[model samples]
Target: METVLIEHFKKARRLFRILLVLALLCTVCIGIAYISIFLYAKIAGPPTLTVPQTAIFYSSNGKVLDELHNGQKRYWVPLESVSDNIKEATLAVEDKRFYDHNGFDIKRIGGAIVADIKAMSKVQGASTITQQYARNLFLEHDKTWTRKFQEALYTIRLEFNYDKDKIFEGYLNTIYYGHGAYGVEAASKTYFNKKAKDLTLSEASMLAGIPKGPTYYSPLLHEENAKERQRIILNLLVDQGKISQKEADKAFVTPLFYAKKAQDEANAKKQDASYFMSAALSQLTNELGITEAMIHSNGLRIYTTLDIDVQKKAEEAMNTVMNKDSDIQTAFVAMDPKTGAVKALIGGRDYKKSPFNRATQAVRQPGSTMKPFLYYAALADGFTESTAMQSEETTFTLDDGVSTYKPSNYNSYYANNPITLAQAIALSDNIYAVKTHLFIGEHRLVETAKSLGVSTPLKQVPSLALGTSPVRVIDMVNAYGIFANGGKEISPTFIKRIETAGGDMVYEAPQEKKQIVDKRLAFLTTHLMTGMFQKELNGYTTVTGKPILKYLSRDYAGKSGTTPTDSWMIGYTPQLVSGVWVGYDQGKQIERVEEKAYAKKMWALFMEDALEGKKKQAFKAPKGLVSVNINPETGDIATKSCSKKYKAYYLTGTQPTTYCRDKGVSEEKNQAPQKQKEQDGFFHRLRDWF
Candidate 1:
């Protein structure tokens, strides 16, 4: 028995020796592994921490107009800027031992391993904050053993390189929050409609709860789930001794003011000056030679000429008047004629629905709005405002194709005889415009449009006189502004300056001006344009017969345009030039008969609001424009004895030399018998040649 006991003791001793050897080897292996990770991290250096900063847009009023973020909507804030409540809540919920652990928690990892083993899938995560930061910053989201091994390796590296504060800041700034928002600042703005620094204890706890499962705990979506998660966080805070049970209960019953998800989403979508910022950024992108990613991430400050009041008014005008569900889109652009500073731009009914800036980007037929360009071309040629053209429809064979084009009046009612050229413009007479366009040489008209800043293509077809050529609203506004400015053309400009976050001025838009036309001719054209809204052009009923002037008492020149699908009302005061376009995005013709009145009324309301405080402005008549009395029927100089007479404006040499025949009251009496019938306002049922 003693011999057997001694042998057993020797066997046990030998087995204990073998087990000691294995334990030492495992300890040595772990030490070497840790040392290797540390050395590798030291050699690899800190991970690239290029967190994107928010880009701010300032309005002319010095108020923050908007902010632009990266694709993830991330805007990094330093650790010091974070709310203490948020930090404690996040620590209590995400990683209580974040400062204690080197990179990971072994007990949590063991539990996760057991859980994953039973579930046969990654149903739980054991990553500490540092480990999560490691996976998010440098590693992938794969759940395989290899990815886990790599994640562990990176976690060790991060712990070796960065402090706890840095790791925490990066994690808080990069973690995904619900509603497509990333980072605490963005999340706070998105979910609470406030800055992250302003987050209350309850709000911070709620936000801190979102990072674990953003979609599942979104306060905007899963309110009950979010409350439950928040409760869990507050309880964890209490258990972690960061707060007492009394404080936790106080936070638990706190009335939370969560951001109205739908309204918040709508506001975010309709962010202030979205279209303006987009257009301004496009201009900057070309000049700076950078992509939009750089624009959003490079921490640039854009100072723009957007007027918040005007912009809001522009939006209000369209929103108050137009049908929301009809899918009809509208555009409003207002610019100072003197400086060409674009004050307001509403690109579409909703910037979220479409970012296509119709104000400056879309090309549509200007309809009768292009007539001023034609008339300006005529004045530059030999024709005066008093020059007469036959108002009846005339057919012209196309030189380019086997087709004949016949242009008719929009109202389909003409004077049946020759009317003065000024009358043609006031009436928007298509036949008279076509005749004058052909007479003035279509090429000359194109040159005139180009000189005035209509940069789109204008095919020299016979229908060009009736605005068949597509042009932008900006182009039309700029062109009309030429007359408003007494022939000096100012380029439409939006951005005033751009600076870097470091206060380096990158871009500053200079005032672009060019003398594009004769001052007298531009003045005469302005005079001719005002006739569209006058009760009569020198005692004869005009085609428009005061359609717009009846709505507003301002002494301004303006015109209305319509295709089957598009409706336009553009006008200018001496102080500002404004244009509004109403149409469908898909080019669907307006369905309502009240469409024109709605469009015009919107224009009038906006103009009234815009010109409210300022004294009414008047266009200056440049030198060398002649005012003369003429025989209404003869289109010639009127003798004092001629009873029927009309006032006309003309260039110095373009005034008529002829006089009324029979030279007396006998002939004037017969011509003056009928008071010109008050012409009905033009409905603009255009002759759709397409």
Candidate 2:
């Protein structure tokens, strides 16, 4: 019995010794692992922060229009520039115990752990503002034990390295707000179109509540959720003694102010001035080898050629006219003829619904709108306005004999009429135009259009006379601008200049001029086309109550055109050239002239508003041009008996050699004849016939 007892005791002693050795080994391994992790965390650098370039659009006068971004990227402003209310709200909501706690809040963390265990879910987070800043700036957003350990260590380093204000500023500037906004500066500007320094107490509280979960409490996406979060933040502010109970109560009742509607947001986004200035900035940035980071974080101050008032008016006109219960989409382009600077441009009604900028991207047949260019080309080709063309019905088969096309006038009744060159263009007789185009080879016409800055591909066909070829709105507007600029083709420019954030002028737009046609021909064509306003105005005023003709005090030229699908009205003064296009995006047929509302209404509104203060300027005729009276229908020397007389003007190079001889007729003869004379004339004609 004694021997068995001794054996049992020895076995128990051995087991106890083994258990003690295992415990010591486990402790040593854990200690080494922890030390290894600590060393790794110390050596590992922060993630490389990649900020995206915030796209800004500015009006011509340098007002911000819009800001665009693909992610939470924006211009970061300093803490001093941020409003005091926003700063206080941020401190109150993000870290109520921030000033009192060390790098780690032991009590809060302990309570959070207990609560998490009891709830069987992680609900509360005990990270201080300093810790959160350190984690966001220097650590990845992982919620593992290892990541938390690293965060705690970095928090200690951050609190030691940075003061409270510095830490708070960093937090305010680095935290992400919803809607692709980062930092208080960007959020304030995005929501209110103001800087961070301009935020009110309510606005500040609303902004501070967003960082808890940006998308979850986004004012744009979840307004009620955002309001709830704001209430919680206001209550916290009151509890933390940052604000009085009454203040909290008032703030809680305050309705959270959100950003404008989508349309207004789009307009607000335009204020950035970058979209119009991007081309120029790209050239400058490339020349300077500017990195992407500098472009985004530097908060660049760009000055552009955009006139803010003009752009606003243009946008308003386009929106008002295009949205009038019609399916038609409209585009408007305005440019300075002398400088070729595009002042205001609205590509489409809404870019979100349709990103295809009809002004820049679409290519369609210009219909009779192409007649001005054709006339200009003919004048350049030694054809005078008095030159007559055979307007008989005609058809032409392609040289390959695979296809045949016939051109007809808009009225479809002047097939056999002998129309003069001036009459052909003014009346937009397709047969006469086709015959004239045939007289001048297709290649020469193409060269003429190309010289005038029509960069689109032109099909060599008889239908080209009626604008069957696809042409972009920019090209068409610039082509018309040639006449306005006295035949000098100036490249259209959207940007005026580009500068760095340090106020360094990186690039300035250069003026480029090239004479595309004869100056005399340009002036002569402009003079002849000025009559179109009188003709088209009669049609427009009969439909709409507004008389656009009375608004044009000077001799301005304009033309209206419609294909089966698209309608266009391109007109110009001496200083400005505006082109408006209206049609369905899918190319539906325009029922009639009355139904063509988009282009005409948009054009009238834009012109009336754009030229408000500017003086009415007339188109100047070049040095050697003369206006003579000729027969209206025959386009020949006027006769005394001919009651209708039209002014026939000619350029120096293409003037009429035979001046119209006018028989001397008394003023009474020119006036209305007596009714008795008309009855006597009818009786005399009947007796002579018998």
Best by lDDT: 1
Residue 48 miss distance in model 2 (angstroms): 6.3
After superposition, candidate 1 runs with Cα above 4 Å error: 1-39, 51-72, 92-126, 156-163, 215-249, 261-332, 336-364, 382-420, 429-432, 486-510, 518-520, 536-540, 543-545, 562-567, 580-602, 622-690
* lDDT of candidate 2 at residue 598, scale 0 to 100: 66
TM-score of 1: 0.74
lDDT of 2: 0.69
List TM-scores for all candidates, in order.
0.74, 0.69
Worst 10 residues of 2 by lDDT: 537-546
lDDT of 2 by residue, 1-690 (tens): 999999999999999999999999999999998686556555653323333336454556556644435455576566798998888888777776777776667887898899899999998877788788778777789779998877777776666555677777777777888776778887887677678998887888888988899889888888889888888878887887788989978877777556657547665655322323444345336654545565555555545566777767877877776556776777778889888888877766666666567777789889878777777776666566666655666677766787887776555556364456655666566776775676566766677778878889998877777788888887888888888889887866765665643457765677877776788888877765665654421210121212356554555677677898998888788878889888888999988555575676677778877887888887767778867666544554465665456777765323333323442222222212354354345335433522
> Could you tell me how far off, in angstroms, the CA of residue 590 lies in candidate 1 after the best superposition?
7.6
Q: How many pairs in model 2 have backbone atoms within 3 A of each other, for residues 3 or more apart or on separate chains, i.e. clashes?
A: 23
- Residue-by-residue lDDT tens digits, candidate 1, 540-617: 345563555666878878888888888888888998888888887778888687776566767877888888899987
